[model samples]
Target: MSQPADYRDPRSLRSRERIIRALRAELRAGRSLTIAAVTGEAKVTRQTFYNNFDSLEEAGWFALLEDFNTLLVDDIQTRWSGASPDFVGLASLRKIVELLRAESSLSLLANGYRDEAGLTGLAAVMLSEIRRFRAEFGDPASPLAQEEDLYTATGLCGLLTVAATGDASSTSIARAAYALLPEWMRQPRL
Candidate 1:
């Protein structure tokens, strides 16, 4: 016998959601996430937090990813659904940059990861999802060769890191990303 899709106990989901929300709030407030911090924020015990996540980074990354998924639903997935790949890719990238403008917390997540653990496993997973989203939703006029895709993804993440560390306003960050990201995206075409 097989279980149906979307099958999880309500209690478990509520507990996890509380933990994620707590972690997210902490990081957004410019506080680095710690086991103690998250447990206190979530009103959960050390054992409960540990049972849900192996480490603080894992929880942080998961919370960030969940937020990304929501952003995708709000801006990219719904609006750009069924649009051409090129259109989707460019639009999504622009939206992503715009999101950085709108949400300071996202910047916290991006730059925070750089120091918490350089090139973390959670980061790789998030990158993979980003690259996949662009590939699937925003295909270029011409197909990108393997290396080109890698470069584009790397450049985008690197730009995010730079933006995250800067003391500029979200508007300034958005402007710089708008100017630079297009050039980087164009590289694969050249």
Candidate 2:
């Protein structure tokens, strides 16, 4: 008989969580984060850290993405529940920009990924959340069309790219995003 797929063990999960916690702690301490620093903080050997993650960059990206997703989703849902359907798109984008401003780690993660995987993943999550918000709105008059998705995704990708580059302050980015809100959503036709 074929063997069943092995699931992640509790210990492995615990170790990974510990590593993430340690990395965040180091970052919070205003210390330059390195693999050695994280391993030391986690009380794990370099080999163990490597065995769990291919590289510090990978771990950083995963941790930041996970954290931002949780925070962003919760904020979006709460805001959507209180706002009109017409407001969903801008509200969601504003929430994302706010998150990018508040969380410095997100910028780090975006900068860390040379490959498109991180950007693609971030875009996918944002797109999914926006779709959910639209569905919840249930406005046939303002349905989320393919073009809207494309525009929102591109705008978010641009924002993330700018944030990652660290060329401008998060406040400036947020303001720029807010300024573009009307054009981005541009209420769907009946």
Candidate 3:
């Protein structure tokens, strides 16, 4: 029996890459992704899109997460290259909340309260990125290191959901969410 094609396959990777590029283009152009829009942007058939992603929302989630995190992580590194790792990550997260607030309409649409399925998908992506960042900065000896993945996923999801709701929260979200980080990961007073 032959192995099935996976994302690692060259052609499959190319197809997925085009689909993601198309998704990003639609979002950057401030267009909602109708099937036609995605297919047109990707220059691939509708069937190709479906083959790579289960739904349009899933594709959007992947594209959004990839673009957002790539920029955010780079910004964090540039701003705090000399600072301790945890400080940089914490600051970056606060910045993320601010950016989300600034892009209120887009954030609201992705929040998915009106569309429960979308909420789950977006939250999953958010949690995955946040948790990955946390682990990168996490203290190996801290209790947090041994906790289940749900610790960061559920906690950050809840925090971000709340942050998304407050219209006047850009400045305050940083300290609020930063306080939730494990004690060992926090920056000490000067």
Top-lDDT structure, candidate number:
3
Q: On lDDT, who's better, 1 or 3? A: 3
lDDT of 1: 0.56
lDDT for each of the candidates? Answer: 0.56, 0.59, 0.61
Instruction: Name the better of 2 and 3 by lDDT.
Output: 3
Error of 1 at 51 (Å): 2.1
lDDT of 1 by residue, 1-190 (tens): 1121332867556767888888778867878767788789989888777666666656665666666666556544544445543454455555555555555564455444442325443344345554555564445444653445455446666675566546665455545544544333433221
Give a tens-digit lDDT track for model 2, residues 1-190.
1111322777666777788889888877878778899999999888767767766666766665676567557655655456553455445445556666565664555346433433444565555554554454424245556557546756766776566456665555655655554342434222
* Runs off by more than 4 Å, candidate 3: 1-4, 28-32, 71-81, 85-87, 102-119, 139-148, 187-190
Candidate 3 Cα deviation (angstroms), residue 80: 9.2
RMSD of each: 6.5, 6.2, 5.3
Models sorted by lDDT, best on top? 3, 2, 1
Answer with 1 or 3, whichever has the higher TM-score: 3
